[model samples]
Target: MRTIVQQGTRCTALAGYVRPDTLDSALAARAKGLRVAAGCTDLFAAVRGPALSGGILDITAIPELRAISETPEHWRLGATATWSDIRLAPLPPAFDGLKAAARELGAAQVQNAGTLGGNLVNASPAADGAPCLLTLEAEVELASRRGTRRLALGDFLTGPRQTALAEDELLTAVLVPKSAAAGHGAFLKLGARRFLVISIAMAAARLDLDGGRVRHAALAVGACSATARRLPAAEAALAGARADAGLAAAITADLVVPGLSPIDDLRASADYRAAAAVTLLRRAVAGLCTGREAAA
Candidate 1:
């Protein structure tokens, strides 16, 4: 049997990992079955699990994959852009909630190296950035030697730790549209510890109001579902309704029915996650209300 630290297949591939400096080269390598390594956080998981697995195709050195740009319609966040980049960016209102979540990602090293694309592809239900981006109705761009295609972020994630990305495709960029850019939003996360811990439950909301009537609302919850999901039912409840404790409670209850589908896990009980998920929704609504009131 292979032993850990054997410097065999898994470690050998990683140890000999080549840094491709161009997008074409990275994409070409990916076309040939090379796995891209952006922070290597998840890569380490596969390597250290006592199995000599697939090799890596290092994408961090590709300059084109790491540029964040602002456009008239939306902000384009590059796939390899670090979490620290998001935290420091003067994002528009809809993404400010995302920036808030970015601050709590992990320790400084992880934040400096962790990329938003990684979070989506890693597909951990507890990923801190997932709920924020999902709530913003973000789109993901995938590129391959063949060409490029775009998919809704929610659709891109198919299940726990799984995504729709093909082996030959690379997650190249994230696009946040203008509507989401100007919307009022908030994100709340619950965990055993404040930082560097996986979330028990999290909620993110983007709301639009006209004359005390909700014109639009987008809410998504994570850590309790197969993947982060937008709460259409809860959002519908908020629509045309005032932002008050009663409306918030109703939305919270609706979330318990559809927004979350928790199961017992080592970090938290399903019952605890179910209750906490609702509480998180309530808190996010309250926070958004407070922010809107302050701005008014």
Candidate 2:
């Protein structure tokens, strides 16, 4: 961490490269309009100019922003926690969807440095984390000098490359309520080859069973919409369904098509994405019922 030069409660790091180890100092830098960055995996890649555009508020130095802790009511995933952190954490099977996405977020190096905050903040329509988190009913915590607030993950992303985060507010944590963490979850994506490829379609699902019947179901699709979205209609159909292959097979392409808004992109046709989403979602549920990994 660099020494902060405080000017009337406002702060700046060396050459304006602010790396504050404390939340207060971080907020102070943010208040000054320094770009808040963690991991910077996207930042560096998106930079086309000879040099970076401006000074950055590096939150990675803040200890509280890099932890994954659990409470009686919820699991708290700090904003700067890396993909590797989630993949390696001893979380319950309910987080299998997130862990599956975490493992395939990028190459090993990107997973080591790409953060949950960066992924959400980037707000890419195809972001793997969004579908997984959405299925888990995650909420995001935003902090500013004025106060702290939370927004459901669905409300956080407004559109492609957009979010509800205010200019002065920093995304501090992601919360998964205990109520939404009752079931096993799975994530799957289809791409041209597989490793290190951007998603053509992606799906995340969670299933909670009771007496051999599905008690709760959540299904989310990404890369097939302007923003990743949860399919409550499809979820409603899955509720009370038997936990078996037939049930999984019932998740036809039409089942999730209404919930998605896929477009014809260079990677794949919109119809293909819609169909792939259904297949992935079905496989996810099938794997859960049969006690196999969903992301085969």
Candidate 3:
């Protein structure tokens, strides 16, 4: 590996940068302890204070790691698929919440550079994408020199800024099953202001209705727990409810109280987040029922 030095910046003693064209090369480099860089939208900001002391493995050039494809069973979103790609893809209505999150991730430039896999691996509690992915029953695909593995999105995230990825493994893809693609989805986020602010509380909902009655429901909330979580109790309550504006009343705050563990942060108090989550949940469910946009 080569050594690098940034002359004018606080970051000094920077290490080598490797851009591999193949997944095999990327995995081999990672196995040797090089820090992986896909879009580097988050990496550059994270390492700005201290110089990168080790080798850098840039995986953006790997062709197989950048495509979004769908199979008979699932939709496969490659690790390097940008938020812009997600917004423009011909996805089903069940992915509407995810698409909405993608549009709200950041400015247009960040959307062009930020990636879905990077977002998941960062594992921030307020990540705009997680709640939508959870409601869609997303899965993560991890690859290493040894082999590959898959884990439920909910299980992959352990806590704030932590994930189940092994050091040598790379998150190669995110998978959404075909069965979960039949529902209508809605996303709602509450922030101090509009555009470009972190969420105080956010909720995503997917509902599959049969003859104006809910056949299946999935509800997830973020920024109020260690990881974004599905409210099984609330989903259970809405399973057979009528798909009308009145459905919002059935989603009482008490049903969601058990799933949240919000903390008092600078953006909002714990109590306020809990209340906002319930309100967002109600709005999301109602939006799905009425075919209206829920996020602002």
Candidate 4:
């Protein structure tokens, strides 16, 4: 086993590792199959999992991959932006809620070092960032020798630890549309402990209000399904409706969709995850209400 450490942080020296500073250079270097490593948070699993299967394309030095910009049409986050970056950003409600989730990802050190792109690439069922990004209608940019393409974050992630990203592509950026930027949103996670624990269930929601009634809404639940999913029934129920305990309860019940396919794991029972996901859904909606009222 070989090891590599930079600035007191542990990384791996795999069979082949290439560090490139530009998008084109990174893409070129990745023409041959290679695993992407930004923060190296999840790369440990790749290095030690089972086999020395592939090379490494280290994109940490790519300047274009570290940008966070706000435009009239969207809030663009570089794939490499750390959880701490999102947490501290002065973003609108949609992203503010995600920032809250980022803060819960781990401890301060993890928040400072773990990258958003890494989370998306890892595509964990319990990833704190996925549900919120799904609700935001975020898009991910994938670059390779073939050129660049974009897809919704939900579409990019096919299943647990699986993504549409190819072996030679690097995730460049995450784009949150302006509509998502202005909407009121919140995220909630239920874990064994408040901090440093994988979520048993989590929910993220965004509400667009018109004259004190929700005109549009998006709701997604994580850890209760194969992938995080938007509660379309719940969203429809909340749309054009006044937010209240009654509405919250109805939405919560409707959130138990069939597609999630949650199974009993060591963390919790299937039934428990399903039930808890609904509770977190309600709380997430309530938090949005609070955020809206605070803004008002």
**Model-by-model lDDT, in order?**
0.78, 0.86, 0.85, 0.79
RMSD of each: 7.4, 5.4, 6.9, 5.5
Error of 3 at 151 (Å): 0.3
Give the Cα error of residue 26 in candidate 4, in Å: 0.7
Residue 270 of model 4, lDDT score:
88
lDDT of 2 by residue, 44-105 (tens): 77754545555778888777787888887888888988999899887878899999999998
Any runs in candidate 3 off by more than 4 Å, and if so which? Answer: 1-15, 49-51, 292-296
Estimated TM-score per prediction? 0.90, 0.92, 0.92, 0.90
Lowest summed lDDT over 10 consecutive residues: which window, candidate 4? Answer: 1-10
The segments of candidate 1 whose C-alpha lies over 4 angstroms from its true place after superposition are 1-15, 49-54, 244-247
Over the stretch 167-259, how does candidate 4's per-residue lDDT look in tens digits? Answer: 778899898888777677788899899999988999888887888888888888888877788778778778888865455766655446564
| Greater-lDDT candidate between 2 and 3 | 2
Residues 35-89 of candidate 3: C-alpha lDDT, one tens digit per residue = 8777788888888534666778777777677788888888888888889988988
* lDDT for each residue of candidate 1 in 1-296, tens digit (9 for 90 to 100): 11111110111223546567777877877887766787877667766432424456877776656777777777788888888888877666788678878888889998988888888888888888888888777999999988999999989989988999999999988988877776677888888899898888888888888886678888888898888888888888788888654567666564455556786788888888888878888788878887777777
Q: Candidate 1: worst 10 consecutive residues by lDDT?
A: 1-10
